[model samples]
Target chain A: MKKFISVLMSALIVGTSVFMLSGCGNGEKQQELNVFNWGEYISNGEDGTIDTIREFENRYNVKVNYTNYESNEEMYNLIKESNSSYDVIVPSDYMISKLIKEDMLEKINFDNVPNFANIMEKYKKTDFDPTGEYSVPYDWGVVALVYNKTMVKEKPKSFSVLWDKQYSGNILMFNNSRDAMAIAMRLKGINPTEITKKDIDVASAYLKEQKPLLKKYVMDQVFTEMEGDQAAMAPYYAGDVAVMMSNNENLDYMLPEEGSNWFMDSMCIPKTTQNKELAEKFINFMLEPEIGKANIEYLGYSTPNQKVYDLLDEDVKNNELNYPKEEYLKKCYTFSDLPQDVYDYMQEEFLKVQA
Target chain B: MKSKAPSIPYLIWMLLFTIIPLIMVIYYAFTDKSGNFTIQTFKDSLFYTDVFIRSLWIALVSTLLCLVLAYPLSYVMSRSSRRGQNILTMLIMLPMWMNFILRIYAWVLLLQNDGLIDLAVKFLGLDVPLLGNAGAVILGMVYNYLPFMILPIHAVMLKIDNSLIEASKDLGANKFNVFRKVVFPLSIPGIISGTTMVFVPTASTFLVAQYLGGTGDKMIGDVIENIFQRDKNVGSAISLVLMVIILLFIIVMNKFGDEEVVA
Candidate 1:
C-alpha cells in the first residue's frame, strides 16, 4: 500500500509538471497585443461580414488577444486589482477621466496613429481628455427615455413621467449608481457632473420617492424586459433602445425636454501595456472606414468617424433616433469625474435609497 | 506509519488561497486607502444594519423552508428501492448541471408578470404578482438550495439500522413517537450540516435578490458588491463583518447540536 501511494504521488507530480510545461511551450515569434472592450460592441464577421480582428492579424502579422467587459466599473476594478497587462481598454468618458486622474493610462502617440484625423471635429478634445492626449473616441450616444406607445395615452416629454404614480410598478430604473443619480439630478435640473453633497441629498431624496414606483432596477436585463413588453418604460442608452425597437415595434425612444446624458466611450492604452506600438497599430486598424462602419452597423451605435458615417446607408443615416437634431444637443451633458468626497457621498446616498 | 504526507498539498493550498486572502481582507478592512491604520470603515458599516438584518431574516426563512421540504423527501428517498433511489438522486441533480446563473434566469422567465406562471393564473381568472417581491426571492433561494438539504439527510437516513426502527415499533411506539425519539435524534448531524450549507450561501447571496426581489429587497451582499466597485476598503470591511456574523452563527449552531446529541 505504501509503494502504491508513492507511485500515485510521483504520477501526480509528473502530470502537474507536464501541464505547466505545455502552457509555456507557446513561445511564438509573433508579437501579441491585448484588446479589451465592451461585450457585443464589436463586429466579428458573423454572417459573412468583415472579420476585423482576423483582418488585423493577417495584415500586421501580429497575434491579438481580445476580451470583453460588461461595465466600465468592472473593467476599472479588474485593471486596478490584477497585474495582467492589458494593452488597450475601452472606457466611457467619466471612467477615462478617472483613469487619467489616477495616472493609470498612457498618452497616445498620434504620429503612430495617423488615422486619428478620421474622427470628426465635434468629438475631439472633449472634457474627459481636455487635450485629446490619452484617448481616441470609439463610439458616442445619448441616454433617452424609452417607452411603449401602446400602453401610454400621450407622448411623455419630460423625465417626470418616470415619477408618475400611475406608472407605478411598470417602470425600470438603471441599476448602477451614477446613471440612476444622473436621471434624478436631471429631473431636478441639477448638473450631474458638478455634483455637491446638497445635490446628492436632494437627488437621493427624489430617488427614494421614486423607489416604490419602480418595478425593478436593472442593467443589461432592460433588453429582455422591454422587448418582452414586461416593462412599459425605462431610461436607457439610445443605441440599446434602437435594437429593442427593431425587435418590438410598439417600443419608441424619446429625448426628454429636460436634457439627458451624452456619453462617449473611448479607447485608451493603459500604462501597464508591454507593447505600446502594437497597441497603436490595433487602434489605427479599428479606425479604418470599413471596420468602423461594420462595428456601428452591428452595435447600432452612433459613430464618430466621418468616413464611416458617410459610408452608412441613407436610411440609417436619416434615423432620427440614432442622430437627433442639433437643438437637442444643446441640453445634453457629458459627465466628468466628480470629487472623491462627492463621489463617495453619491454612492452612500444611492445605497440609502435602495436600503 | 506514513503520517502527514498526503495532507501536505492540502495544507499548502489552504495557506495560499484561503488563509492569505482572508488575511488580506482583514488588512484592508482595518486600513484606509492610504495604508494608514483606521477604524472608520468598521464604523461606516454600522450604518448598514438594516441590510444585515434583512439578509439574516431572508436566509433564516429560506433555510427553514428547505428543511421543511427536504426532510420528507429525503425520508421517502431513503426508504425507496436502490434503483429508485438512484433515479431520484439523479433527477434532483439534473438542474445543477446547467450554469447557476442560467437556472436563475429560467425562473425569471417563468415568474415575470406576463410569464408562464402569470399566464396560467390568468387562465384561471386570477391575477398574481409572482415576481419582484420578497416571496419570489425566498422561493428562488429555496429552489436552489433544497438539494443541499436533501443530500446530507438522505445519506444519514440510508445508514440507519432497520432493526432499531423495528425495536421502537416493538416497544409499542407509534409512528410519530418513532420519528420523534429515534429518527429525529439520529438525523441531527445531517440537519446541522445541511443548515450550515444552505444558510451561509443564502445570507451572502446578491444574485437571487437582484433578479427576483423588488426594489426594497437589497441584501448586505449587494451593498458589499456595490461598494467594492467604488471603494474596496469599505467593501472589505463589510465583508469582514459578514464573515464574523456567519462564523458566530455556525459556532452557536454547533453548540446546540452537541448539547442535543449529548441529551
Candidate 2:
C-alpha cells in the first residue's frame, strides 16, 4: 500500500511538471538563433557604438538569442551537456581543438559564409582548425608583460624579470591556473601547448619559487593595480594592457623575447545547433568589415579581418600593443588542448604550489 | 488542528531543490565521471588538506575577532535608549545598503599601499605591507562578518531583564560579579548563535583572500571552484568532506552549549 501510494504521487508530480513546462511558450513562433559569446565582446549600441546584434536581427527577420560565457571550459561544458542548444559559440583555439577532437563542433559550411574571404591569409590557416573547417577566426591577441615605466626603470624584454627580487612585493601574477602555468612553462623552456606531467612539475616548482615575490594573484584586479600605479609589473593580455596604458601614461608593455602565449577566440557552430544556416549567416555578418571594425574598436582586441585593418585609423593600426608585428608572431606559440591526465596533473600541482 | 496541505507546496519545493541536489552531490562524491563507483576522488581531495586547514584557521581567527569586537558593542547597543539603538543599527546596516563587492573594493582602496590605512600607519612610523598577506584576508573577513555577529547577540542581549542585574546588585554583588554570575551566563545562547553566524560563512568564503591576500593564501573553496571546471567528482568529494567537518563542528558546538541555549 505504501509503495503504491509513493508511485502514484511521483507519477502525478511528473505529469504536472510535463504539463506546466509544455505551457511555457504561447506567443507566435518566430525563427530564433542562439549565439553564445564572451561578455562585453560585442558592441551593443552603447556610447554611440553600433548595436551588432540589433543590426543582425534587423537584417534577418529572425530574433536572436545571445548569451555570454566567461571561459572556454564553461562554454564547452554547457554545449556538451546538450540541455541548451546554441547556434554559435566563440571559443578559443585550444577549446576549438578539444571540441573537434570530441566531434562536438559542426564543420562550417563556407558556402554560406562568403565573408570568410575577408579574413587575412595569416589568420586563415594555422593551428587548432588547420583546414578552417570547424571554426571562424573572430579576434586574436597575445600575452605580454605590462609594467609600470617609472618603477621598473628598464624596458622588460623577458619573462624572467617577473622573478627578479628587485620588484618583489610589487609584482602580480595571473590568478588563473592555465595562464600562470603557461608562463612558468615558457620560462622553463617548455612549450605550453605540448606539456607533460614532468613538465608541469618543473613549472609548478618554478611557480612555488616565485610565489614569495608576488604581491597577489589577480584577474581583473590587474587593471586596478597597474592603472593605479600600485604594482610595478604584471603579466596580462596585450589588448587589455593597451587599454590600461591608455588610462595610465606611466605604463608600458613588453612582448617577451623568448616567446609568449598567442591566443585567438573564434566562432563555431556546435553539432547540437538547431539553426545551422542562421548560424553561418550570422558568422558571415560578423565578418563584414564595418561590423568587425566597430566590434574590435569597442572591444579593444586585435582583429583578424583584413579589410577592417585597412580601414583602421593610422595610429590604431600602428599601435603594436594591439597589433604585434609578424616577427613577434613568429616568437609566439598558441596553446592547444592537453590530454586529460596532463591537464588534471597541472591543476592539482598548481593548487599544491599555492598551498 | 492544522492542515498538512499548507506545507505541501513547500514540501515539493524542498524535495526538488534541496533533497534532490543533496542526493546528486552524494552520488557525484562517490562516483567517477562515467558513474563508476570510486574512492579515487576522495584520495585526490586529500592533496588539498593544507588549504582546508588554512581556511579553517583563518575563519577561526576572524570569528574570534568578531566576537571580541561585537560582544561589547552589542551590549552597549542593547542598553541604549530605543531611538539611540535604532540609530546605531542603522549605522551598522548603512554600509550594507551599498553593493557587497563595492564595500570590499572600498576596503581594498583603504588597505592598499599608499592608500588611506597604509599612509596613516606610515605616518606613525609603522611600515607593514598593509595588503597581500594572511592578516589582510583576516581583516577583510572580520570587517565583512562583524554585523552578523552583532545583530544576533544584540537581539538576545535586549531580552536580558534589567531587573536581573539590579537584583544581583541589591544582593551586594558588584558590577563585575553581577555580570559574571548573571548577565554573562545568560548571554551564552547569543554567543553560540553569533559564533555560528560568523564562523560557517567565513570558512567557506572565497573572494576575501583572492582580493586581499597574496598568492599563497588560496583557500579550499577556491580549490573546489578551480577543480569544478574540469573535475566535479573530486570537487564534490572535497565539498562533501568540508560539509562533514562543518557538520561535526556545529554538533560539537551545540554539545558545548546547554540544551535550551542551542536551537
Candidate 3:
C-alpha cells in the first residue's frame, strides 16, 4: 500500500508539472496577454463601474493575466530578470527611462495603436521618451502638502513649514528615499532632477535637521493619520489628498511654492514579450474614451487622455487638487533616472540621516 | 533502504528551496553587478554599521521585554489545571490567528495621536505622544513576540515534574529557593529556545519599525530591503553579514545555555 501511495504521488507530481508547462504554452484558442500594474491604480468594475479588463477580453477575444506590483523598482527587477512572461507593465517616469536605457522596453508600433493620438500634446515626445517611440502615457499627478487646516493657524506657502519647530512631532514625510530627498532639494532651491553628491549631502543634512520635527516617515498610513488628525501636515500625492479630503472636512492640500515632483506612470511593452500585437491592442483599448473615463473617475488621478479629461464631471475638471493649472505644471519637475552610483549614494545618505 | 527512499524527496526539497537559495545569496554577496568576484559589496555594507547596531539594540530590548512579560504569564498558566492551561494557551494564541499586519494596524489605531490610549490619557489631563517613536516599535515587537516566548516555555513547563518541586520543598527549601534551584534551572532549555525564537525575528523585522518607529529609527532590515530593490549584490552582502551575526548570536546563546546546564 505504501509503495502504491509513493507511485501515485510521483505520478501526480509529474502530471502537475506537465500541466503547468502546457499551461504556459500557446495551446488555448484565445491568446493570453500578461499585464502588471501598480496596486489599486486601476478600476476593476466596482460599484456598477465598467470592468476594463473584461471589456477588452470580450472585445478582442484575448485573455489578460493581470497582476499588481507595489513599487516601480520591484516591477523593474522582475521584468529585467525575466521579461518573457509579462507583455505590458505600468511604471513611473524614472523607471520607464531606466527600462529604455537598459534596452528592456520595446518601441511601440504606432501603426497598430492609432489611438496614440488621443494622448495630450504636452505628454508626447518628452524627456523620458524623446522621440515618443517607447511608451504611452497612462496617468499623471503632482506631489502636494496635505494638512489639517485647524492645526495650523496660517497657510503653509513653502516647504519650510515642514521644518518649523512649533509643529515638531506633528509632521509626516515620505518613507521612500527619492520623494523625501526631492522635497529637501526643492526646499534648498536646488533642482531635484539634476542632483549631485554635494546636493545630496546638503539635502541629507537638511532632512536630518528636520528629523526631530517629523512625526513619522510614512506611506499609505498618511491617509489614516492625516484624516484622523493624528498629523498636522504631510507631503503626499495630490490624488491621495483628494481621497483624504473627501473623508475629512478639516483636511486641505496645497502645492508647495518652491516646486514639487510631477510624476507620470506609463504603460510599455517589454522587449521579451511574445504577444506584442496583443499588448498594443490592450493599450489601445485602455485609451478608449469610456475606459479612460472610468479609470480616471475611479483613480482620482489626472488623465493624460484629452477625451477623458473633456468627459469628466465639471466639478472634477475644475478641481485644482486633481488637475492643477498650467502655472503649477510649469514649476513641477519630473524625476529622471539617476546614474547607479548617484542612486546608491543617495540611498546611503538617506539611510545615514535615518540612522 | 525503503525508508531512505522516502528521504530522497525531503533531501531534494532542501536542495531546491534552502541550499540553492543560500548558495545564490553567498554567490551574489561575493560578486559585483557584472558577476565578477569582489568584496566591495561587503565593504559597502560596512558603511551602515550604525543601522545594524541600532537594530540589534532595539531587538535586544524587545526580546528582554518579551521574556519579562511572558515568564510570569507562562508560569501562572503552567500552575493552572490542564483545562485552565489549555484555555489560557488558546487565549494567548487566539490573536495570532488573525493577520499579523492587521494586528499591527490595530495597534497603530490604538497608539496614534488622538487614538484610544491618547483619548483616555487626555481625559485624565495628561497628553502623550504614543505613535511614531522607538517606544512604539519596542511595544509592537514585544506584543507580537510575547507569544513566541510564552509557547516554548509553556511547553517545557508542562513537562516539568511536580515530584521535583515537592522534594525541593521537603528538603527544607523555601518557595523562592525551590523556584530558583528547581523550576528556573529546569526551564533553562525553554528560556534559551524562546529567546532564540523572539530575538531572531525581532532583530530582522522591518515592518514593525517602519510602521511604528520615527524617522530616526531605521533598522538594518529596512536598509537591506531598500538595497535589495535597487542593487541585489549589496543587499545580498548585507544579508550575509546579518546571517553571520545571527549565527554568532545563536552560538553565544547556546554557550550560555550550556553554562546554565553545567551550573
DockQ scores for all predicted structures:
0.55, 0.58, 0.50
Write one digit per residue (lDDT tens) for candidate 3, span B1-263. 24688789999999999999999999999999999999999998898898899899999999999989888888888889989998998989899999999988888888877788878988899887787788999999999989999999988887888899999899999999988999998899999999999999988888888888877788999888877876889899999999999999999999999999899
Chain A only, candidate 3, TM-score: 0.91
Segments in model 2 whose C-alpha atoms lie over 4 Å from true places: A1-30, B1-16, B259-263
What is each model's TM-score for chain A? Answer: 0.90, 0.91, 0.91
Candidate 1 lDDT by residue in tens digits, A10-104: 99999999987876786646899999999988889997778888999999888889999998878998899899899999999999999999999
lDDT of 2 by residue, B1-263 (tens): 88899899999999999999989889999999899999999998898898999999999999999999999999999999999999999999888788878878888899888899999999999999888889998998998999999999899899999999989899999989988888777887788889988889988877788887877788888888877777889989999999998888888877878764443
Q: Which ten-residue region of model 2 chain A has the weakest summed lDDT?
A: A21-30
Tens-digit lDDT track for model 1 on B133-232? Answer: 9899999999898899999999999998889999999999999999999999998899999999999999999888999989989989989988887777
User: Which candidate model has the greater TM-score, 1 or 3?
Assistant: 1
lDDT of each: 0.91, 0.89, 0.89
Name every residue pair that clashes in candidate 2: none
In model 2, what is the error at residue A23, expressed in angstroms? 19
Clashing pairs in 3: none
Backbone clashes in candidate 3 total 0
Worst 10 residues of 2 chain B by lDDT: B254-263
The number of the candidate with the highest lDDT is 1
Each candidate structure's TM-score, on Cα atoms with residue i matched to residue i, is 0.90, 0.90, 0.89
Off by over 4 Å in 1: A1-29, A74-86, A99-114, A271-278
Please report, as a value between 0 and 1, the fraction of native contacts recovered by candidate 3: 0.77
